[model samples]
Target: MGTWDIGPFDNDTAADFSYRVDEAPDGERADVLLAAFREVTGTGDEYLDADLAMEAIASAALLAAQCPGGEPVTTSYGPKKPLGVLPGELRPPAVAALDRILAADSELLELWEESGADEWKAGVLRLREVLTGA
Candidate 1:
């Protein structure tokens, strides 16, 4: 929950997630990203934890980096090694996770709303647009 900026990898949970991605076997990094996305998307009607949301955001950022017009993840806190070409299949779930995070029950959204960080929300929206090529 130690968020220092609006970027996906700026928070402690997401920074830790980047390490998980870096440490995962090359073929398993996408699994790590999928798990993060599913954790948020599968939350259903339950309150979505901010940490989970952060990890999902980080996951989406990594995937989005490979898309056309997507910015490369340059944060030092992001994965150090290249993630290889991620599956295009991940985009749908990444967008779903983002939608869930922006939903009313998301703790991350609540926190950002309280903090008046419209840019954070906007960043998440931009990620969605990138994933959907909208």
Candidate 2:
């Protein structure tokens, strides 16, 4: 019914390993962010941790704005045949997934908005690339 808090897991970049179904980026912090990302996105089959997610989202802010143009970069897929209209059987999952991801993202955005953390806000915007599979 709530979210999970998987603590700072040791990231081993030397080896290739994926802890979840979604693909994580090269950054260790990004990987941690994705863990929460999946949880918030419900892309994974479980709850997501809050602290770790905060940490990753925070870290991304330190990096340069990778994409200086476009609305935003995303990879997450919603329905296609009827895209925004939602599908018939898989409609629930598609809608749910998008909701989860957006909600998790919203949490961070709201926080940065309140704190006026411009760097974190920038990172949140960049998160589109990581959160969305597009």
Candidate 3:
């Protein structure tokens, strides 16, 4: 259960509050990573406004890209659960946010490639496509 504190962001309420990554549960690495992304970006709950949701998506992308090996290591305050299936209301905003983040951050794409997170990236892409198409 090792942990790494990445850094604090302006969205965070406390200066000491930071994004962190922790070891994944068995057979749940991808879901854990996704959850981590949402948690770190402030989108883990149902209370987010559209703006915060967008920020969360961008932050998640940044974390995924910056993550070493692109594995699921991010952690937050809560019981571990699968994030592969997001609520319907969140899909549209998540897609838009991801698109915005991807468009703005070439480095994240490069990091996704470099980290060999093909499956994770593909899943995200699929989610984006589905949300956009719907």
Candidate 4:
């Protein structure tokens, strides 16, 4: 996927958060970025539109980078809300696109060293757990 500019969504706050996430390195910085995205996007609610879905998927891909093999993290709890409700046929390709984005970005994983953002990191990890199925 090409670089996404923040369009008119939630008074442009979504764009700001997305940009931050895009710029963040791995570890705590990335975790904070993801948390900010979730907070600004209000992703916890149901009925995610396409733009929000893409944002959530991108965040998920970033979180997946921290996990080994980039596979979904298995967890004991289920997802609270649908991350992005894509059509059945489109879901696979969308996920593939996000994975490609993650793969192409080397700096994301390279900066995964500890940064003392434990709370934010745990928040992103919890979202990952929900996304992947715990």
**Per-candidate clashes, comma-separated:** 0, 8, 3, 4
lDDT of 3 by residue, 1-134 (tens): 01122221223321112222224444443443345335434433233343333334433433343233333423343223343433344444455455543443333444445656466456556445544554
Q: Which candidate wins on TM-score?
A: 1
Error of 3 at 78 (Å): 7.2
Candidate 1 lDDT, 30-105, residue by residue in tens: 9999999999989899999999999999999999999997999998999998899999999999999999999989
Q: Candidate 2 — which pairs collide?
A: 41-101, 74-134, 75-132, 75-133, 75-134, 76-132, 76-133, 76-134
User: What lDDT score goes with residue 127 in model 4?
Assistant: 43
* 58: Cα error in model 2, Å: 7.3
Model 4 off-target regions past 4 Å? 1-18, 22-28, 31-33, 36-46, 71-134
Q: What are the models' TM-scores?
A: 0.97, 0.29, 0.33, 0.30
Question: Which regions in candidate 1 have their CA more than 4 angstroms from the true location?
Answer: none
lDDT score for candidate 2 against the true structure: 0.32
RMSD for all candidates, in order, please.
0.9, 12.6, 11.7, 15.2
Give the lDDT of residue 90 in candidate 3: 47
| Residue 127 local lDDT, model 1 | 93
